[model samples]
Target: MNSFFARKYVIQGIFISVAILIIARLFYLQIIDDSYLLSANNNVLRKVIVYPARGVILDRNGEVLVQNEPVYDLIVTPREAKDIDTLLLCNLINIDTVGFRKRMDKARAQSPYRASIFEKQLSSRTYAKLQEHLYKFRGFYVQNRTVRSYPDSMAAQFLGYILEVNDRDIERSKGFYKAGDYIGASGVESSYEELLRGNRGVKNLMVDALNRPKGIFSEGKYDTLAVSGDGLVSSLDKDLQILAERLMKNKIGSVVAIEPSSGEILSFVSSPSYDPNLMVGRERGNNYMKLLNDPHKPMFDRPIQASYPPGSVFKVVAALTAQQAGVIDQHSTFMCPGYYSYGGGRARMRCTHVHGTTSLVHSIEGSCNTYYGHVYARMIDSRGMSGPKAYDLWREGIMKFGIGQKLGIDLPGEKPGLIPTSDFYTKRYGSTKWRSGYNISLSIGQGEMGITPLQMANIMAIVANRGFYYRPHLIKGIGEKKIVKEEFTEKIYAGVDTKYYESVIEGMSRVVNQPGGTGYSVRINGIEMCGKTGTVQNPHGENHAVFFAFAPRENPKIAIAVFVENAGYGGTWAGPIASMLVEKHLKDTITIPKYIQDRIFNANLLPAVKVAAPKAKDAAKVAANTTAGLPKSRIPSTLRINADFSPRVNEDNARVNPLIEFNSQVYE
Candidate 1:
C-alpha cells in the first residue's frame, strides 16, 4: 500500500511539472517573439513623419521667386480608420463621395498600418473646419506640408516644377524614399534637389488607452526634428527676366543673356511659358500631362532645345575660322558680284545683294554670303584635296565655336548643333562621290547646320571676351551660399586664337556702330555694341530673325541672343530684342521706342508652329545630329535654300500671337 501511494505521487508531480513547462513556453511565444512584439508596436505607438520645409529660391539679387507655403494633407491608416463622417469629409474637400470612397478603398488595400493621404493641399478654410471636428473621427488626421508657390510668377523654365516620388524615382533613390514625397522634377529644382530636400524627420509618440497621443511621453527622447531646406540664390535677374518675357510677349522665341566676364546667365526667357505655380502637388499631374502633350510645346526649353540655322550670324563664325586657319586675313579681299560662282557656267552662289570687292571685315559687317563661298572654296580646294577634305576643314572651324556638340552646359537638354565632318559625307554618299556644292547652305549656317540659342548666346560671350567663355550656367549661389564649383571660374575656349577673336570682335563692333552694318538700327547713342544678324530658313516658308550681341565694347559686360521665329530679318526682329535686353541689363530699364516694343511684343507665329510630319521620328534627331556637329554624311540631297533670308520685310506682325498655346489646355 505504501509503494503504490508513492508511485502515484511521483507520476502526479511529473505531469504537473510538464504542464507548467508547456504554459511557460506558450507565454514565451506569445509575449517574447518578434511577430508579437511588432503587433504590439503597431497597435500603440503610431509613427508620424514630419517632412522638412523645402528651401526658398531667390534671384542673384536675393529676391525670393519660389518659396514654400503651408498646406495640409489628410492622412489615414486603414486598420485604425473607422471614419465616422465620409460625406462631410468629401464635401469639405471637394471630392465626390464616390471618389472619396474609391480612394479610401485603395488606401485600405495598400496597407492597414501604413498611413495614406486622401486629400493634398487642403485650403485654410477647410483645415479649420477639420481641426474643429477632428475628435469625431478615428485614425484620421491632418499632416502639415508645403507646396511650391511662385509669387512673382516669372522665370517658369528656370524654376522647374515639383512632383510626387514615382516608382522609378524611388527605385533610383534606394530604400531612402517612398511614394508621396515631393521631388524636384525639372530646372533648378532637380539640380539642387539634395540641398533643397533636407532630412526626413520623425516624432515618436506614446499613446493612452484611447489611442490619443500623450504629450511628450518620453520628453523628446525618441524625436528627430525636421530641418528646412537651405535657401538658394540663383544667378537670374528677375527684373530682366520679367522684362524679357514682357518684351517677348506675342512672339515665339527665346532670349539668353549672360555676363561675359563671368558665365552667369542673367536672364533666360522662353516664350509660351506658363507660371510654375500651376505645377505642385495635386495640380502637377494634370498640368504636366497637359504640357507634355501641348502642341506649341510650352514646356520646351527653347533656349537650349530649339536649334536654328545660325543664319547670317553664322557668317561671323565663318570669317573668324577663315582668319584662324590663315585662309584669309582681315585685309584679304573677295570680289562679290552679289554671288559666288564655283563652276561659273551659271552656278554663282547667290548673295543678298552685289557686294563688290569686300574684305573680311566688310564681308562680316555686310554679311556677304559670297565672301564665305570664296572662303569655303579656299579651305577645301587650297589643300588640293577632295570635297571630304574641304568638308573636314569646315568641320574643324565649326567645332572651334562649340557647335555640333553639347557646350556641356550645366542646364539640361542642351542640343549641340551640327558641324559637318568627312565621316558624315562618307555615310551618306558612299565616300566615293560627294562634292562641296551639294552642301553650300552650310557656308551660311543652313543646309544641315543647327545651333541652339544658348550656344548662340555663348558664341557672343566668346566674341565679347575675345578668346574664351565660362560655361553658361544659371545658378550663382545656393542659400546665400556659393557652390565652390570649378565652373564658376572655369574657362572654355571656342578654339580661336586671341588675335583671331580680336579681329572678329572689331568687325562685329562695326556691324552695330557702322552705317553699312545690318544692325545699325540697334546702335545706341552712348553705348557701343558688337552685333551679328542671322536669318534662319525653315521649311514652313518663313524665316527666323536671330541676333547675337555684347555691349559697351571696351569692358564687355553682357552678351545676348534673341530669336524670333518667322519674324523676318535678324535686324528687324532679333536685333531690337537684343538691344532692349542689353539696355535693360545695363540701365535696369529699357527705353526702346514704345511703339516698336509694343509691336514686337504682340507678334504671333502660331500658323507656322507645326512643320510637316517627318516620315520617321529619328529623322529630325538625325538631322539635328548631322547639322550640329556630326561628321557630314555625304548627305543625300536634302532640302535647302542658299541665300540670306532677311525676315519681316514689309510684313505685318501686329496680328500675330505666338502665345496661342501658353495655357496647357490649348497647347498640350
Candidate 2:
C-alpha cells in the first residue's frame, strides 16, 4: 500500500513537469518570437510600394526638356485570387484573356502570397475605367507610377532613353531593384540616374476579401512618404540646339558647340536623328529595333562616338607644336612648288595651288600642304632630338589639347579616338626603317590619326581661351541648390604657352577675314570670326567637309565644330553651316541671304539604298556588324550618300562665289 502511494506521487510530479514545458513553449511562440504573428498579419494587410516621380530636366533658360507623366501598374496576389470575371478584367486593361492567364501564372510562380505586377504602364484612361470595376476582381489593385515625356522631341541621344531592368541590372543594384523597375540606359539620364530615380516608400494597407484597399493600416503609422527626384539644369541652350538640329536636318554627320570661357556645351546635334518620343511608352522595343536596323544609323552618337581623320584641320596642331618646339615662328617661310616631295622624291603630296614663299599666316589662309609638310619635317629631324623622341613629344603636345583620349564628358560610350604611339610604328615598319617621311601624311592630319567631333570642338575652345580651358560639360547645375561640380570649373592648360596662341589665332583670323582665305566666303560681315577648314580624305567616297571656329575673336563667346560626310570642300558646306550657328548664337539672327540658308535646308545627302531589316532575334548581331570593321575616315560605304551636290551661287553676290572653288586639297 506504501509503494502504490509513492508511484502515484511520482506520476503527479511527471504530469506537472510536462504542463510547465507546454506553457513555456506557448509563451515563447506568443511573445518572444513574432514570425507567426507577422505571417498572420500579412494575410489581411497588403504592403504596397509607392514610386516617386523622376526628376525633370531643364535647359539653361529654365525650359523643360524632360518631364514625368503619370501611369499605373496592376498588382496581383495569386493566393487571394479566386473565381472572377477574367474577360471583364482583360477588356478593361486592354489585354486578352490568354495574356491575363499567363500573367497570373507568372505571379503564382514568383510567389502566391506576395504581390507582383500583372500589367505595367497602363494609360490613365485605362486606369480610370478599371478603378470603378476593381472591386469586382479579387486579388488585384492599381499602383501609380511615372514614365518620361519629352516636350520638344529633340536631343534623342543627348537626353537618352529608359527601359525596364534586366537580370544584370537587378544584380548590379543588389536588392534595390526588382524585375520591373526602370533604369537609365544612356546620356544624361544614365550619368545622373542616382539623383534622378529618387526614393521609394511603402504603405501597409488593409484590404477586404475582394482585394480593394479599404484604408491605411494602423492609421498610417507604419507608412513612409516618397521623395521626388532632384531637378537637373542642363547647359544646353534651347534656341541654339534647335537651330543646330534644323541646319543638320538632311545631312549625315555631327555638330558640337561650346561656350569658350565656361566650357559649357551649348549645342549638340547628330544628324539623321529621330524624335525622342519614339523611345517612350509601350512601343519602345519596336522603335529601338527599327532604329538599330536603320541604314543611316540615326542612333549613333556622332559627336562623341564617330572617329575620323581631322584632315587639314590637324595642321593647326602641327603649327602649334612646331612653334612650341622653337622650330618655327610667325615669320618663318617655306616655298611651295605645288607639291611636297619626300621619301627621296619617290613620293609627293600635292597642294591646291603653287604658293611661292608661303609665310606662317599665309600657309594657314591658303591651306597650303607643302608649307606644313616642311614645318613638320623640321620639327621631327632638324631638332637635336631623335625621331622617336620628337614624335613622342609631338603626340604629348597634341594629347594636352584633349586629343586621342576620352574628354570625360558626362555621356556614355565616348570613343578615345586613335593616336598611335611610337611603339605602334616600330611594330609596323621596324625600329630604324621608319622615319619622319614614312608618316609624312600625318603632317596634314592623315595617316592613322583619328579624332571625334567633340575632341575637335574642345580644341577650338582651348585656342579661344588662349591655351587654357575648362572641361567641356553638359550639366549646368544639379538639384535645387544649383551645385556645379568643381572639376568642370578647374582650368586645364594645353601645354602650349599663352604667347604661342596669338600667332595661331592671327592666322585663323586671316583664314576668315583675308581675301585669299579659304573660309572667306562664309565669314560674317560684322563679327570678327577666326576659323579653319578641312577637306578630310575618304577611301569610300567624296571627302568629308570639316570646319571649327570661335566667334568675335576676342573674349570669344561660342566655339563650334561641324562635320559633314561626303560633302566635298570644307569651306563650301561645313564653313557656311558653322557661320550660321555662330550668327544665330551671338546675333540671334542670321544675316546671310535667304538663298544661302535655303541651300543647306534643301540638300538631301542621305543614302538612297535601304538595307534589309534584321529579324528581332538578330538585331543586336546586325548592329554590331554594321558599326564594326569600317575605315575611320568614313562611315560605312553601304550607307554612303549617292547624291553629289554643290552650293548654287547667285551671280550677283561676289563674296559667295569663292565657295564654288575647291580651295583645300588632299594627297598621299
Top-lDDT candidate index: 2
The runs of at least 3 residues in candidate 1 whose Cα sits more than 4 Å from the true structure, single-residue gaps closed, are: 1-44, 207-213, 344-346, 608-668
Q: What's the true lDDT of residue 261 in model 1?
A: 90
**lDDT (C-alpha) at residue 332 in model 2:** 95
lDDT value, residue 650 of candidate 1: 24
Q: What TM-score would you give candidate 2 relative to the actual structure?
A: 0.86
Model 2 per-residue lDDT at 223? 98
lDDT of candidate 2 vs native? 0.84
* Top of the candidates by TM-score: 2
Taking all chains together, each candidate's TM-score versus the true structure is: 0.84, 0.86
- Model 1, 579-640: lDDT tens digits are 88898778776676888787777767554334454456566775666566534455432411
| Clash count per candidate | 30, 0
The sequence of per-residue lDDT tens digits that candidate 2 reaches over residues 1-668 is 99999999999999999999999999999999865664466456887888899999999999999999999988887876777799999899888988988999999999987789998889899999999999897778888899999999898889998889999999989878887889899889998998999989999998766665678989999999989988999999988888889889889999999998998999999998989888887678899999999889999999999999998678887888788888998889999998787767765667867999998878877788889889878977776777888788888988998999999888898999989998887776666445677677678787788999999999999989988888889998999999898889999998888888887888899988888688888889899999998878775667788998998899999999999998878888889899999999899989877888898878887756646656767766765676677675555534333324444322211110111212234521
